[model samples]
Target: MWNPKATVENALILLLLTLSVMAKTVFSQNCQNTGCPGLKECCSSWGSCGIKDDQCGFWCFSGPCNLTNKSYGFNYNVSAGPRGPIESIVTPSLFKRIMSKVGNNCPAKGFYTHHAFISAVKSFQAYKRTVAKREVAAILTHFAHGSEGFCYKEDKARGKYCSPSKKYPCEPGKQYYGRGPLQSIRWNEYYGAASIFLRLPLLKDPDRVAQSPEVAFKLALWFWTTNVRPALYLGFGESSKRVDGRLCDNLHPNDTKNLVNQYVNLCKILEITPDEDARSEISAFWRRHLSALMKRCASTRASIITGRYGLSFVR
Candidate 1:
C-alpha cells in the first residue's frame, strides 16, 4: 500500500479532475442574464451553451437551433463571390448614414469601410442570392447594434475563447478573443475552420480580422451563413435568439424590444416593409438605446470574462 508510483498516479488523477471542473465553470454558458458568447453554440432550456442536439434542439434558446444540431458549417465556398454586389443594398449613402451614428473618435469609424464590406461580399457569391431584403436588413440591424455602426474593431477585454481539443489543442502563446463585426467568436475550432477558406494563419494570428476591414466583413459573413441563416425563416425573433438566446421569449424584453425596433427601421431604409411579426418602427429610439446597452454589456463582461480560460493554456 505504501507504493510511491501509485501515490504519484493518484495525484495526477486528482489534478486532471480539478482541471475538468474548472473547464466546465469556465465554459458554463449560463445565459440566464447575458447570452452565450459562441457564434454557433446553443443555449438550452436549462441555461447552458453547447453545439449538441441536446443543447441546440427542442427548446434551444438561440444559435443554429435545429433538429439537425450537428454542425459541418466550416466548409465554405468563395467561388460564388462578386456575382452580384452587396453594395446595391449597402450603398455609399446608406453606409454613411450608419457610420454617422458613431462619433468621429470611434475605432470602427476608420476601420469599417464601404469598399471593404463590398470586397468581403464579393468573396461570398451566394450571400446576396440567398438573403432577401428583410434578411439583409436583419443582418444590418445586428451590425449596427453589435459593432456600433461598424466602429468597434476589436474587443480589448475578453476571455481568450479557447477550449481544450486534441485537433486544436490550446497553443502556448495564442489567444483567440473577439474581433470582426459580431465579435462573439472565442473558440479555436472556429479560428482553424475560418482559416481554411481565408488561407491565412488565423489560429496563430487572430488579430488579422480586426486589423483588415475586408477580412473582418468576410468573417462576419462566415458567421452568419453558418449560424443564423438556418433559423431566420421563423421570424425576426428567431434571428435574435441566434445572436443571443437570453434576449428572447421574455427573457430580456428590454433588449428584445430594441432589436425588433432596429430591424423595423433598417427594413424601411431598404424600402422593404416587414410584416407584423417584424414589429416595424420608423423612429431611431431603439438605435440609441441599443448603443447604450451594448456599451454597458461590454463593460460588465470585460470585467469578468477572463475567467473563461486558463492563462497558461490559452496564452
Candidate 2:
C-alpha cells in the first residue's frame, strides 16, 4: 500500500537531519571547549549553541548566564568598555616609539601598525583587567618575540599542521601554523578556539590571521588573555613557562633570557619597574596615577637593542 502521508513525513525528517548536519559543519567550532561566539551567546552545559536564554540559560564555557546550574567562569562585565583603553594606554606616538626599535632591515614593518594593534585590541574587553605598566610590557614583549620583532608576517604555509578531530576538522587546502603575534599554533584547538571566541570565520579562513594585521593582533590577544594573563600573578617566569615551558627548561636558555631582558627593556621604556605578582603591579602602578598618566604614553626612549630569536616563533 502506497502511503503518501508516511512518505511526506519521512522526507521532512531527512530534510531536518540534513539541515542539522549543515549547521554543525558550518558553525560548530568546538563550542564544548571555548563556548559559542559573542559575549552573551550560550553554549549549553552539554555542548549546544543558542542565545543566552536557551537551555535554562546555562552558559557552559562562557557567561555568568542568567539560567545556569553552575557558573564555572565567565568574562562578564570585565571588558574595558570599548575603543578607548588600548588607545589611552598605547597611543600612536608611543607605539611608534616602540616600533622604532625594529631594525630597518626587518620585513613586514608596515604590517604591525599601531592602528592595527588598537583596532584588534577593541574586540578584547577582558584585556582591561590586564592593563598595567608591567603587564603591558609583558604583553608587548611576547608580541615582539613571537612575531620576531614584527618582521615575519606569514609562515611558509608548509607542513600540514592539522590534526584529525571531529570537533574542529581541518579545511582540506588550509594550513594552520600559528600566525600573528601569538603565532597561535595547533589548528585542531587554538584556531577553532579562536573561531568560537572571536565570532569570526577563522576556521574556514585561517589566513585572515596573517593577512590582516588587526586580525593578527586579535589572535595574539586571544592567546594572551586566555592563557598568559591568568598566570601573570604567579610572576614573569611562570608566565614565560606558560608560553613555552621548553625554553624555560634550558631548551633555549638564551631565548628565555631574551624574554626577561626584553621585558626589562620595555619596562624601562615605560619607566616602570619590572616585578612579580601582576595584581600588586597593577595596584602599585595605579597608586602612582600621576606618573602613570604621563607614562601611559610611554615614549620610546633611546634605541631598543636587537634581540635575535629562532625562526620558529610558535607558541
Candidate 3:
C-alpha cells in the first residue's frame, strides 16, 4: 500500500512540467503589442518570457517604451543603438546651460569636451524608448550636486583605488582617486570596466577621467545608464537604494519614508512635478466638494425652489 517509489516518480514528473512552463520563449516583436505571458515577465531579445534581468537584458525590444531594464544603463553604437528614431527631449543648448550652471569652474576642454559629452548622451538616450524631460533634468541635478556644481575631480588624493587583480592592475606610481563628474569611488574596477567597454585605456591612465571633460561626462553617463536609470524607473525609493546599495531605512536612518527626499528636492530645483499622487488627491478633493455641494442644495431646495409667486426667495 505504501508505494514510495511511484510517488517519487510522480513528483519528479510534475517538477519537470513546471520547469517547462516557466521557461516559455517568444519572439520580441510578437510580445511588443500583446505583452508577455506573465504580468511580471518581460520578453527577452531572444524572444523568451522571463523575469528580471532575463527579460530586461540587452536583447529586449529596443523601442520608445521605457520598459527595458534600466537597473544598469545599456550602451549602443552611434549608428546601431535602439530600433527607433532617437529624439533628444533635452536640447543641446539647454544641456549646455544646465552644465554651466551646475558645474564647477573647470572648462569642458581637452579630451573632456562638451561635444563628446553630447554625443555620449545621444547614444545613451537611444537605449530608452521614452526619455522624459524630468528625467533629463534629474540627471543634471544629481551631477551638479555630486560635483558641487562643477566638472570637478577631488583635489585631495586619499590613496590609490587600485584593485590589484590579474584582470586590472594598478600602474606603479599611479593613483586612482575619485575622478569624473560623478566622482567614481574605486576607479580601478569601475573605470577599468568602462574603459574596456568604451575601448579606451582608462585603467592604464585613470587620471584621464579627471583631465578630460568628455571622459568625465562619459563616466557619469555610464553610471546613470547602468546603475541609476533602471532603479529610477521603479521609483525614487528604488533609485536611492540602487545608488546607496542598502535598505531605504539605513540611508535615511532618522526617517526611512523620507529617504527619497533628496531626489524630491532635486526635482523641485528642476521644477519637475512629483509623481501623480498630488494630482490624484486634488481631483478627489474636488469631486468630494462637488458631491457635498450638490447634496446640500438638494436638501435645501426651498432656498431657490421654482415658485409661481414671481422670484420670491424661501429659506
By lDDT, the best candidate is 1
Runs in model 1 lying further than 4 Å from the true structure: 1-41, 49-53, 67-85, 128-131, 246-252, 276-315
Residue 99, model 2: Cα distance from true site in angstroms? 1.6
Between candidates 2 and 3, the one scoring higher on lDDT is 2
> How would the candidate models be sorted by TM-score, starting from the highest?
1, 2, 3
User: Candidate 2 — what's its lDDT?
Assistant: 0.57
Q: All candidates' lDDT scores?
A: 0.61, 0.57, 0.47
lDDT string, candidate 3, 29-123, tens digits: 44432334332354443444556665554333311113332432321111111123224444556556555554344643223345665666765
- Residue-level lDDT for 19 in candidate 3: 79
> Residue 5 of model 1: what lDDT?
96
TM-score of 2: 0.59
lDDT tens digits, residue span 1-315, model 1? 599999999999999999998788655654533455554667665667889987676667655667332222111111211223466778899887877777888877778888987778767766645446666777778766667556697865666767766665656777776687877655787777777766777877888888898988887777777777765544444455565444532334334465666776776777665433233244333332233223223334423432332111110
TM of each candidate vs. truth: 0.69, 0.59, 0.49
Number of the predicted model whose TM-score against the real structure is largest: 1
Task: State the weakest 10-residue window (summed lDDT) of model 1.
Answer: 72-81
lDDT of 3: 0.47
Worst ten-residue run, lDDT, model 2? Answer: 296-305
Q: What lDDT score goes with residue 295 in model 2? A: 20
